[model samples]
Target: MPNDSPYKAALQKLFRTRLVARLDDLRQALKRQSRTTILHALRAVGYLTSYSHAGRYYTLERIPQFDPKGLWRYRQIGFSSRGTLRATLIHLVETSPAGQTHTELQDLLHLRVHDTLRLLVRARELQRKPFQDTYVYLSAKPKPASRQWAERQKLAPPPAPKERNLARVIDILVDLLHHPEDDARAVCQRLRAGGHPVTRAQIETIWAHYHLKKTPHVRSRHGRL
Candidate 1:
C-alpha cells in the first residue's frame, strides 16, 4: 500500500465501478427487501459471506471496490459469472505456461466460456498467440522487480526485451480505454511522439476487444419460447 492511496476517499470515486454499485445496491435493498430478495441479489453480485455459530465470519480477503461493475472489463472479455474470477485466472495461467485455450480452460477451471474469455482479455496478463483460426493464451512475460536499496544491487532476471516492450505498450492502451473520452487519434499520436511504435491497427484491436458493445437482442412474442 502506498502512502497516498486514496481508497478511503469519498464514495464518488469508489462507486464509479459496477461491482461497487452492486454491493451498495445490495446493502440498501437488503434493508427494505425480504431475505429471499436479499439472497437473490447477493447471488447475482457474488456476495456469499458465511457466518459461523460463534458469530465468526469467513470469506476471501477483498477490497471495498470488489463489485460486478468494476468487473466490467473482465466480463467484456468473457470470464462469465463473478466470484474470484480474477484470482483464479491469474493462478491458473501462472502455473500452466504455454497458455490454455477457451474450451480446455473452461472445463479445467469449471468456468463457462463467456466468463473465462472475459477475464483473460481484461487482465491483459495473458499473451494471445495466434494459431490458425483461434488463439492460445500464453502467460504475459512479467517485468522483473527492482531490488530494494537495502539489498545489493544485482541484475534481476528480465523478460525478453521485446516482451517487456510490448507489455508496456499494451498496458498504456488498456489505460487509455478506461478513459474513453480521451481522443483515440490524439492519444495514439502522442504515444508515437513519445517514441512508442503503436500503429493504428494495434490501437483498433485494443478498442475492439475492450470496447465491447452489449446491445440487447429483442425477440418477437411468437419467436420467444
Candidate 2:
C-alpha cells in the first residue's frame, strides 16, 4: 500500500478502535495489538497494495493477504509443518506411552526421523526425556486422554488400505501367515530371493490383511503372518 493509501487508513482506523498513541509510536503500537485484532484488521482490509522501493517499480509487491491468515489458522489447527508433525507425534505419544521411537515416527508421520525431531524441538511442543533418547510431548497440565486414551488405543483396528492388490499377493500372505512369528521383512526378502516379486508396501499389505503385529522390530521376530 502507498504510505498514504485509503486501505492503510481503514486498517489504521480499525486497529485504533480502542487505542491511544502519539503520532510517532502510533504505527508500532497499532501493529502490536492482540493477534486476533491484528488478524481481523488484516483480513478485513489488507491486500497487496503495491508500491516501489529504490525507484524499482513493483505490483502487489508484498501486500498482506487473507491466504496467509488461513495459513496461520491452519498452523494453529495442526495442518502444516510443525502443526502436522506435532499432531502425529502427540497422537503417537499419547497412544503409545512407550513413546514412538525414531523409526516409528518415520512410518507414522511419513517423515524422516531427523526432520520430525527437528520440528518437534523447534516448536517446543515435545521434549526429549532425560537420560534417554526418547521424546515426549510437553504439557503445562495433564490432558484428559494423556494415559487413559493410550489404553483404549491398544485395541484400535489395523489401518485401512489405499488400493487393491492382486489375489496372488493374498495367497502368499496366507502362506506366510500359516507360519508363526514370521519375520515380515524376512518373508518379503525370501519371496524376493525366490523371484516372487512384491513391493514393500505389498508385503506390509499382506501383513495387515492378516492383522499381524506390525511393529518396527518385527524384523527381529518370525511368526504368524
Candidate 3:
C-alpha cells in the first residue's frame, strides 16, 4: 500500500484512539477482508504485534514506552522491542550480569517461563546451572556464561551454618543476659567486637532453638529494679 492510502490513515486513527487493537479490529478499521492487506497497512504505518495474548493484538510502534528491558504492557498485554518472548528471554539471560533464575525471570517478565527456559536450555541457546537452591540461566557462549556464573557466586549470600556452634551459642546467650534488648544482629555485632567469631545465622539458630525473644528492658524512675 502507498503512504497516501486511505486504509493507512484509518489504521493510524484507530490505533491513536484505542492504543491497541486485535487483528479483527484492524481488519474492520482498514475495511479489508484479506489479512495480507491489513498487514501491509499496519506495516505502512509502523506497527508492533503484542508479544503476549498469543500475539493477538497490535499497536503503532510509537505507542509503546518500552522500559530498560525493552518491554511494555498495555492492559495486561505485553509487547517487546526484542520481538518475541523467546527472543526476549535469550537477550535478558545473555545480557544479565549474574544471569537470572526462573523466579527472577518470572518476577521481571510477570509471566511463567519454565517451558521456554527448558527449551532454550535443551537447544543450547541458553545455559543453566545450580545456584544455591535454584538454577541460574546464563548465556550459551562459554566465556560469557563463565563470567555470569562467577559474578553470581560473588553476589550470593553466605551459606547458613548447617549446625549451631555450641560455643557461639553460649557466648550469644551470655551477651543477651547483659543486653536484653539486643536483637540477633546487634548481638552478632557486639560478639564480633568482643573477639567472638559469632555470625548472625548462629545467633538466629540459638534464638530459634531456645525460643528466645528480645524485649526492651524497663527501669523504674524512683531507682527501683
Candidate 4:
C-alpha cells in the first residue's frame, strides 16, 4: 500500500498495537460499510489471510512469533504464520507433541478438516485408528503414534461416574437423543424447565458414564494448553 493512503496509514497504526483482525473487525476498524470495502483494503495492503480454522482473520505482511502449531489464535480468529493450508496442517501434525485427530484438529482449527486429513493419510503423511465411532489421526511414524495413544489413555476422563437411578438417567438420555448436540448446561436448562433437577455436573457425569465425547485441549502458540 502507498505510504500516504489513508487506509494504509490507518492499518499500520492499528496493527502496530493489535496484530490481527477478522472481516468484521477490519470493517469496523476501517469504518467501512461493506465486506467488499474491507476486501479491497486488504488487497491494497498485501495482507495475509488465515488459511486454516475459520479463515476469518487477516494480518499485516508479517507476524514475528508463532507456536509449534504454526498458528496464532485470539478467540475465534486465527492467523497462520505458515504459508498455506496444507503446509500449516502438516506443520501442526508433524510437530505436535502427539498425533492429532480430525475432531481435535477441527476444534483447534475451528473448521472442518476431515477431507484434508483423509488426503494426508492417503498420502502416507498420517495414519489413523478406529476410536469409538470415529478415528484418531496417528503419526505415520510409529513412536509418536504410540506415545499419543498412551497420553490419550492417560488423559481419558477417569471412568465416568457409575450410573445410578436408571429410570431418570434413561429419561434424560432419551431427551438428549432428540438433540444430540446439547451440552450439559443446555440439557440442564431444558430439564429444569421441564421440572427435573438435573444439574450440569449430573449431566456431565452421565456423559462420562457413557463415554459420549471427548474434547481435547490444544496448546497455544506458546505451547501451553
Expressed as tens digits, the lDDT of each residue in 80-116 for candidate 3 is 8987888999999998999999999888878889999
Clashes of each: 16, 10, 0, 0
Question: What number of backbone clashes does candidate 2 have, counting pairs of residues 3 or more apart or in separate chains?
Answer: 10
lDDT-better candidate, 1 vs 3: 3
TM-score of 1: 0.27
Off by over 4 Å in 1: 1-83, 115-119, 142-225
TM-score of each: 0.27, 0.24, 0.75, 0.45
What is the alpha-carbon lDDT of model 1 when measured against the actual structure? 0.44
TM-score leader: 3
Root-mean-square deviation of candidate 2: 15.7
- Sort every candidate by TM-score, greatest first: 3, 4, 1, 2
User: Could you tell me the lDDT of residue 151 within candidate 1?
Assistant: 21
lDDT tens digits by residue: candidate 4, 13-63: 778888777677777678776777667777787777777544556787666
Question: Model 2: which residue pairs collide?
Answer: 48-63, 177-225, 180-223, 180-224, 181-222, 181-223, 181-224, 182-222, 182-223, 183-222
For candidate 2, the per-residue lDDT at 157 reads 58
- Which residue runs does candidate 4 get wrong by more than 4 Å? 1-47, 53-58, 64-68, 74-77, 156-225
Error of 2 at 34 (Å): 62
